[model samples]
Target chain A: MAINKNSNGYIIIYTVVMVVIVGALLAFLATSLKGKQDANVLNEQKVSIMKAFGEADANFDGVVTMGRINGGEFTVVEKADQQAVFELLGNRKALGEATDNLPIFQMEKDGVVKYVLPIVGKGLWGDIWGYVSLQQTEDNIIITGIVMDHAGETPGLGAEIATAKVQDMFAGKALYDATGAFAVRMQKGGAKNEHQVDAITGGTKTCDGVNAMLETSIGKYESFLRGAEAEVEADTAAAEECTCGECCEEEIVEPINEEE
Target chain B: MKLSKNFTNPLAANNPVIVQILGICSALAVTVKLEPALVMGLSVTFVTAFSNLVMSLLRNGLPSRIRIIVQLVVIATLVIVVDQFLRAYMYDVSKQLSVYVGLIITNCIVMGRVEAFALGNKPWDSFVDGVANGLGYAFILVLVAFFREFFGSGSLLGFKILGDWYTPNALMLFPPMALIIIGCIIWVHRSINKDLQEK
Candidate 1:
């Protein structure tokens, strides 16, 4: 018996069967791939953090230390529990009520210690975020490198923030001004001082977002930054105060060579 | 001989982008860079080939009243699966292509092949036609993307070819430039193939 191809009953049955088969296929694929996708995302975060630290292809296993700021105190996170820190960054939002725990990563290379902070903020269209690498000098903290990304900023305009040209400008720029305010920003006309960088030509709003992102996110680590800065200053001051101490003893040997 | 004609016809004489003027939207959108455009091309090829094969195999049993809906369901499912696979395996390219992979469901080439050729042909013949049409579209996409990426960003496939002294043409990075390049391709293609020109 030939089936009636145009009958309503056949259409309904065909539709139901087709829908069920397609749905099951897609559901099965999504479930099977979820683990791999999650791993990719986590690896991407780790790579971004490494890139921001200016160490591409660097091993992340034992080199970087993960931590969080809780109750105005910084605490190191164990390696096993570090997955939660990455998840926290993935779910971060702009202007969400400041959470008790703020994620931070620390890495040391060539005797210089760098702090990598995960920051989230709003751009013209959607969420903007990045890892900012900061180093402490004798008096202040300066950005060493940064790697930014956006959910949906306009390409070539606001999205320029993600480009190396823009991010490279953050390097050597101090996070604090002489007045000691969180003064780093994207200057509109052109940056005139160390605290600013030139903003994208047509990306004023997104630059403003970056400015806010840097201020609020980095500002949350003020206590940690101040402590780090004080330690550096104290070390230099103590070195200068020594006349016959370890630092001066080395200098004295150098002076004797000059005299000879 | 018939299969060979089916395969070769779409490559140039009945090209999907230039001759048929189909799939211009994505051609413009993804052609700003070579990498994403190549991925888009391959993804479209995958969707069109499989969709054609499936539709052709099911053509006899498919009810005439719900043909379009069935085609859509098939195309949508294929596109989603491709998207999931991309996210899992090629995360960076998946991020770059972003929504265009999902938008393959709306690409006319996939549906057009299934409707115009697949439903009436043998599965093997339909599959060849699908691949040819997809590649025909891919050929134009890669050609346009080469010029765009080279001039627009002074690079090819993310590698900088021009030195610092060379300034990139900003206009080439936009969608309008893709259109202009495609228009130029059509002009050159028609000049060579006289019969394709409208009287």
Candidate 2:
């Protein structure tokens, strides 16, 4: 007898077989490519960090993950040395979960050690994130380099945040003033000082996202930087106190401001 | 000559976008950039051809009641595989293309061919028809993207052709303008093919 192609049993069997096969294949493909996709994200982050650290034309080489630091106004940890991506969590001071740990990448250029901080926040449509690198100055943290990128920003409008043209506006913009307030921003109209950059022609919302991300991400690093500054001062103090063998003393320096 | 007709008919007389107006949504979305338009066109070409071949191979066994589901499963699997391969190998392009690649599963053109041509034709012939229809769809998509990208973006394949002095027309980048362009193409196509005009 000729088989009834429309039989219920036949339809069910065909569906089950097809679903299992398709499900397995897609699962296998996603799992197999997960490693490569993770690597790509890491490499892209590296490029952004590197670009933020040196001249756009600089031939700077090498990228080191350095380590992760858990920081906020209330807590301080130095050189935590956590290396796993799964274990690493950098909260966008404004959006990330309260328990997230911040990841930092470090690179050296022209004898200057630059620390790169990755910032993530919202764009008009989706997530916008970037790397902001700071050069430790004698007194404060100076914004040396920045690279901004987005997930679903309008290609010609908000998406301009990712382009070198927009990111270049961030070069030399200081995240903190002489008194150390997070003052750097992506602002509209004409910029009067080093803290501002002109917003994209049609990307005002995205610019706002970039500004907010910097504020939250950079503010979280305030204490850590202050610690570094005190460490530098302590080094100076120790050297001066060690004049000859008669007097040698290590001065106690407050690592961070514990009061609000 | 008879075999060639299957390939040539869709390019002009039986065009998918202009004549049938089946896949206009993608034609509008992907045409904003020539680079994406080219990639989307090729991807659709692959989906259409391969899905048609597979459906035709199983046509005799396809349960009449469950044919649509079977066709959808086949088309969806193909689209996912293509999307994954793209993400792994052509990540930037894949990102730009984004959800549209998955939307190919819903692109009526793929479904239309499976139901219309593949359901009835020999496997080889169905494959040819699918490719022919894809090229037909692509021809219109690339045409729309060319005008949109050139006038709307002042560029071709992401390369700047217009001088710095040129101001891009934002209207061309908008989706409605794509409809207008497709409308004009349909008008021109119908004008040339007098037989296509309704009495």
Candidate 3:
């Protein structure tokens, strides 16, 4: 073959050889970094979970001590006899049927279990998600921490939802009442009580979305909380029987003749 | 060797985007913000200059049957190196650039130079040719980006250049503005350089 700068065959052979070399190099580099990349992703998830719990100051490397709600453990529970799946928004049967799944993390301390579950909802510009922890007693949920990010929202306005002050509002907020009615709401002007979370004035839509997300996400755990409460009552009853305390002794005395 | 007007001409007279109407795709896509445009300009410059140099050097020994393939191979190789370096160091910028950096392998500017000048010239002359042409491309891109970033975001290099009161024009962030800006540049360039006007 005549060698020429303009020849097509020369270019073909050169291209093939160059491509082979470059491809091999890229493959080697990718493989070498694969492990580190995977580890980074796992670390990020752990950090997100920790930050959600307001435990950002806790040492993440060492063994995490579980609190009353197992800070490290979470679970997914479905409401019994309810077709509506607990979701980030108010229960929508269609949306529930689509995902039909939830996550709950349990933090265990001295054999007691506390669970942190995640909440997801839509923000003004994009989707928002957060985590909330509940006590085994089913009395209320402590807003441990939250994380919010957006796709294309304005930087200073809607984006402020991710700020610390905004996320802090969720701490120690209750998800339900004695009647099992979900009362979580984002007040427009300001929160009325410690239990009510104040909405982001600039981010009204996002606040509404978050309010909806919490009701739906927490509502799904209704059945799980009921079961947990029942189990606790049974355990407490059994423990009381074993102890020869004043109450137990009185019960054993065959209810000293009511007339006397 | 006498410096043919062809060697220095494109830097201004036949500028790629502003004059020749080539490479406008990147000019619009990356110009939405300043930093990405700057990085994209430099990346293209590096690829163009080196690819031209390499192609000219091998022009003599290349087989007549496959010279174009060899040109593409050289351009593609240089592009990969640039892409890797960006990924290693400027990871955030690289992420923003995403697949656009890799798409440089197919940029018409690099291929056009190799075909037009590298095949006909000596390596040193070809290197200069590459630099001149690449600069011409960069000049247009920077001008477009300056306008886009300034009006669109009220900032430069992510710093707020416009005062607190200045509201950004959202339309500038989209790709359509790039085309309009490029058209304006061409109009101005042609108006000033009467010889460049279409007959």
- Best DockQ goes to which candidate? 1
lDDT scores for all predictions? 0.87, 0.77, 0.67
> Candidate 1, which segments miss by more than 4 Å at Cα?
A92-98, A123-126, A152-160, A201-208, A226-260
Model 1 lDDT per residue over B28-119, tens place: 88887899899999999999999999999999999999999999999999999899999999998887787789999999999999999999
Give me the displacement of residue A74 in model 3, in angstroms.
Answer: 3.6
For each prediction, how big is the interface RMSD?
1.4, 1.7, 5.3
Candidate 3 lDDT over A197-244, as tens digits, reads: 787645688878878877776666666655565445445554756565
The C-alpha local distance difference test score for the whole of candidate 1 amounts to: 0.87
Question: Residue B148 in model 3: shift from native, Å?
Answer: 1.4
Stretch of 10 with least lDDT, candidate 3 chain A: A81-90
Model 2 clash count equals 1
Instruction: Give the candidate order by descending TM-score.
Output: 1, 2, 3
Candidate achieving the largest lDDT: 1
Q: Which residue pairs of candidate 1 clash?
A: none
Candidate achieving the largest TM-score: 1
Q: What does candidate 2's lDDT look like per residue over A1-260, in tens digits?
A: 98877788888888888889889988998899877876665555556666777645544333343645565322323334332432333233443533345566666656777888778789898888878888776545678778887767766678778877777777777666645567787778757677778886667898898888888777666667676765665566567665653332233354422222
Candidate 3 reference-contact recovery: 0.31
Ranking by DockQ: 1, 2, 3
